[model samples]
Target: MAHSHDSTALDLPLPARRHQTLALVLVRRLAGHGLHDARATMLALDAGGTEFRRLLVLARALVVDLARTSRRRILLAPCCAAGMTRDEGLLMAMIGGGGLDVHGVLTDDAGCAIAMTTAHALGDELERLATRNDWRR
Candidate 1:
């Protein structure tokens, strides 16, 4: 959705509404972590040239949430999380939504560790799919 400088909330397109909601979720979470500049961040994000551009900005901003070491809450960065691919982010959201604890992994040992989504049916499905996919690069 393209927002004109004069457009009001009621005039926003459907896709823009979704983008705004996702961005707000991240900004609100950031505020809880004592970020006073969240409103400013939101405004800047809204100024992005395109919808995908805005999403990318929001995703990168939420990466800060992923960096925080917390055991009480799970934070997601849309289609982009630190060291995570789009598929990984979607998988994490699916599994994480199942009332399970999830977190981003920062390990120097594996050299492959990234986000940690809970293991369940979704995880099993992902595993099966990955096994059949031999073109990993």
Candidate 2:
């Protein structure tokens, strides 16, 4: 069976052609890897539309940093493309839930170093949470 619409409208919450276009772009990019594999990655992320926007923005920002390869290697970086890891998202969720002033930057070799003063017990809790959550700290 075939379906037709009188008007060119999609019943998506995104409500903008740009949104659909970007999604299609990402899908096509992922398709280069393999449709099934790409879909699995997308589904595994369980990402929302806003996250897609974030990825597009980051990809555009780092275009200079990324090589001009046909594979679009910039999209492969989970940190920029996917924004935050699961535990990072969870930590943000917790921070947003409360008024915690946990500000820090992640270093490749050196590990997380908070600038603010943290109590020993709280630091231990944060460390435990980081390990348990499997964050990239």
Candidate 3:
């Protein structure tokens, strides 16, 4: 499903789908197994209701996934519009716990660039992961 430019609400078949998609994309850049934990967190959060909970959950999932997979060398290129919150910080902490480094990259000045870059990066990561874990193989 296509995401809106001005909204956090995801257009997905189910909350799980949304969570998985976001998690898969976010985890690819990071360096180790934290992605699995992050995905679980996101799934739980997706079942809850709160202010921007879905978006927050998705963001956290990505952070944790990256941290778990990457060996402490992941940069968080967050959109400026993607305001930082306590949940986000918590997610960062989780990523850090997974032996990954986190750096923040704000993208308020260039929304389009940020969006494109994020999409590309996420896509690349997902593809790499899929290939590495080829279930069909």
Candidate 4:
């Protein structure tokens, strides 16, 4: 006798699936909020324009709860007056001395590196939080 084989699979864990669904919902909400498309948003941000700055600000704001829960420290660099810098400054200030550190730099390149470093540090904290079962499900 011959047997037929099927190769389709869905391998996500329950909590992970729920988290992914929540993320998708958030993405849809972002798109509805004038982010256009996710790919377009990524391109725009990579291109570094006013829209990019706005999108970054929105993205950062959306992740504030996660940052707080993770006890992440963010160092913000000031580059423009178009609101992103202002908003990040406000966020860092709100986090106070222990939680986040805000630094203003002269060039966009320096600012980008600082932001990247902050993100890296935050990622480590988030990982630790996850390992310790401190992350919200």
Candidate 5:
């Protein structure tokens, strides 16, 4: 008997491959923003379906914000895909529960270099994902 499985991204189905591509593109987008280990990040993402779509939308927004702002770094908390809702207050709730007094930061930057580079590098797929109204699909 021999084990059979998709050995490469190319071996996966079309949707799966698209997910992988999106994940890779996102990882690249984050690379300039102090994110490390592109390969590991891509693998850990395991992107697909609605949650994956949500992640893409959140990540693209975060990346865009990072690019535009002068924030030195972003603090990304670890959470499951199910927690990746569009609710902006979730992070604040998490912090409250943890007894942490954290608040948002504002920066002044006339021109953003990262926005010029990485945000634009993400291309139109991110915009498409962001604009998509049907997450169930």
Candidate 6:
């Protein structure tokens, strides 16, 4: 099932597509939190460049960190609500659903915590993976 001739986002290389998905997920999360203009962020992602790559890396790192604790929802709840915000829940779902596909059962905070810790320990290695040339298109 190769769409070598497709002329859509599907036609993009695998790594590029992965980064695109990552970017979209982050953008939506940020928008939900009212941290940035969704339209502008999307435009920036559409433009795609070194800066976008950096953003993807940072987003990935944040996800990795937050997933580091199942208590994150509880801990961060005070930041904006009585429990996990919609955006936080979405990020957790993303990691659990194969956005990062890190090993372990991400369904629970405990498991997510362990898996994220493993990812965080990789540090620069993760950044290198997220910012590789293939991510640029």
TM per model?
0.23, 0.18, 0.27, 0.22, 0.28, 0.25
Query: lDDT per residue, candidate 5, 10-127, as tens digits?
Result: 3212222343234434544454434444543453355433445445554455455654564443333223121221111222222122111221221123244443233333333443
* Candidate 6 lDDT, 41-89, residue by residue in tens: 5644654554555454455455445544544232122222323433334
lDDT of 4 by residue, 1-82 (tens): 2112111122212224222222223333443444444653664354334434543444444344333333223323222112
What would the TM-score be for candidate 3 when compared with the true structure? 0.27
The most accurate candidate by lDDT is 6
Model 2 C-alpha lDDT per residue in residues 1-137, reported as the tens digit of each score: 22231222322232123322233334334433443344534532333332333343332322222122212121222221423233232223222222232222111111222211122223333333334445433
Task: Write model 1 residue lDDT over 1-137, tens digit each, in one string.
Answer: 22122222222222223323344344334534434355434544544423334333434444443344232233223322223333234324433232222233221112222323322332333333334443123
Tens digit per residue, CA lDDT, model 3, 1-137 = 32222233222222123333344333332213343446444443443333234434444444544334332233333322233233233233333231112222222222223222333343344334434445223
RMSD (Cα, Å) for all candidates, in order, is: 17.1, 19.0, 14.5, 18.4, 15.4, 16.5
Off by over 4 Å in 4: 1-111, 134-137
lDDT of 1 at 15: 20
Of 1 and 5, the candidate ahead on lDDT is 5
Candidate 4 versus the native: TM-score?
0.22
Q: What TM-score should be assigned to candidate 6? A: 0.25
Window of ten residues with lowest summed lDDT in model 6: 6-15
Q: Is candidate 2 or candidate 6 better by TM-score?
A: 6
Give the C-alpha miss distance for residue 61 in model 5, angstroms: 14
Number of clashes in model 3?
A: 11
